[model samples]
Target: GGGGSTTVTTSTDTDLWKDIEAGVTKLLSPAGKVVVDKQSSNVLVTDLPKFLDRIASFLESVEGSVQRQVLIEARILEVTLTGEYQFGLDWGAITQAAALKGASTLSAGKILAQKFAPASGGFQIGVASTDFTALLSVLNSQGELKVISSPKLATLNNQTAVIRAGTDEVFFETRVLETPSLTGTQTSKTVNPRTVTIGVVLGITPQIGADGTVVLHIHPTVTEKRGEAKSAIGDTFPIIDVREADMIVRAREGQVVVIGGLMQEKRINNDSKVPLLGDLPGIGRLFSSTSQEVRKTELVVLLSPTVMVGKKVDEITSRELERLNKTKGRSPW
Candidate 1:
């Protein structure tokens, strides 16, 4: 019975082995190979369209990104006329002449004449016989005066002369006199004249905008140098009349703008001394001559701007640098 069971098991195992060999031969056949090749080709064929579309989309995206980049440049501007201009005035000298007409005595007139002895070409002094008291009263009442006429000299002889005042029609005769002095006899006469100086200074800065507009900033200063004064510390300093202003203006390229009517005025009070008598309460007004001087002036400024572009700017800047180098006779780096 054991032998019979062993033979049966052996027979079953042999049949199983035979079945496995047949399955392996079927799988290795040419028709099976064809089936595998067909499946692989189908997969490749199916994925190829999508892969090609992805590649096309990537190329389109790269092209569109490239198109978005752009190059940009700015227009340049070349500016000129950055400098200072000045104008000036002196009032102390102008007032001295007006005071001379009101002087009461020869001593007072001589004092004023000496003070204004340095008259130059632009101004002249005229003297005629008139009521000094009347002149003083009129000057005091009006607080200002204009010379109505100028004097002309006429020779009566070698030793005498006549002064004719025009329009006012006044005349005076003078005879030359000789006096004996310790050293020798000499001829001298006192003469007085007055003059004035006036000035103004302007500084400018300009900037150009991208849209062809210009912005201009200006600094203007007015200085009137009256004369000199001694400080309480015994230091001498200039009596300066100064006024300043800062302004901003806007205009189109190549347009001119005018800034005008900047005006200034100054008043100074001066007294000729009698020392303690001049300082005395109330009565000081009589001993000391109190006078007021006023000065006024006006200023105007003009500016223009031009815009440069492209090749013009390059050429101009290069030429300007070359010219500057030539003028300086050295390299300005």
Candidate 2:
């Protein structure tokens, strides 16, 4: 459309032919080397005839879709030309202009039809001159354009085929209609340990001395607490039950008893809870006088957004989802 006058001028047309010959020569010339037998070979040396055939093939290929001199016209304005096909239709310059207009690859087919389709007519094979002029003006003003790929109905057919083949089973069935921008506070409470009945032996009977005094005995007692998960507080937490075992009584005196068990006690001069050995009659004297620090632990529930509800959880509904998709205008049209 731009060089229509120049196309008719004989002197001006000579330059266009020269440019085409130069392009063909460049394509036929081995621009790079080919590796053969572990040795680098120039394309001109390796296959000059093949390169010539390629350039000739390209010239013949564009006969039906594009004119050979369009490149020389666009080259005068420093505009780049690219070849693209859409739904088997060729718009040539108009397609390039559409790409400059921020059209996507997905939109290639539909955009060609919309822009090239004649009004009050059936269909046209090539882009109209008026459309090319309009697109060129847009390109000159915008300096550059984007190409986008528009979604097509053919994808639906592929999905249907996959479903029929049993390869497209539904993995995630839930979809949020309106995503909540803000998160609601999770309501959860701490749970107390279930009341577990336990029998604790304090001490064995101690032998009395001649003056009716009782001797104290003691030994080291180890206690282990087993923790379990409980959901009594609307959330799961760990609960520990301190199990007491029989205490080793080293000695006893005058009806004073020695027993096997660990007891709970508070540390002296400190608020930290500590376990103290249970009192035994003569065993206290044999080892040392002590107090029990036996304890049973209850679960304390904590609410957090990162809590896992199931074994595997999908958090795409969370506020963090804004970073994942990052695309806009996802609504089906």
lDDT of each: 0.33, 0.24
Q: Model 1, residue 178: displacement in angstroms?
A: 54
- The digit string of per-residue lDDT tens for model 1 on 1-333 reads 011000000011123223322322222213222111322322111223333343334333333322221111111111111112112222233235434664222111111211111222111112212232433333333223233222222111111111111111112223345789999998764433322223434443434444555444444444456577664534444565555555555555433343333334457687796989988998987888878965543232333344333212222334433543454533222
Candidate 2 has an lDDT of 0.24
**Which residue pairs come into collision in candidate 1?**
87-199, 87-200, 88-198, 88-199, 89-197, 89-198, 89-199, 90-197
TM-score of 2: 0.13
Clashes of each: 8, 43
**Model 1, TM vs. native:** 0.25
**Among all candidates shown, the one with the greatest TM-score:** 1
Tens-digit lDDT track for model 2 on 1-333?
011111111111223233333434444333523322212211122335545445445434423212211100111121222233211123354345655554322121111111211112122211122222344464344322222111111111001100000011111122224433458544443433332212111111211232323221111111222344544334333333333222212111111111111222223331322234224554444444445443221111000011111110111122123432352334212
- The reply for model 1, stretches above 4 Å from the true place, is 1-198, 232-234, 264-297, 309-333
Residue 5's lDDT in candidate 2: 18
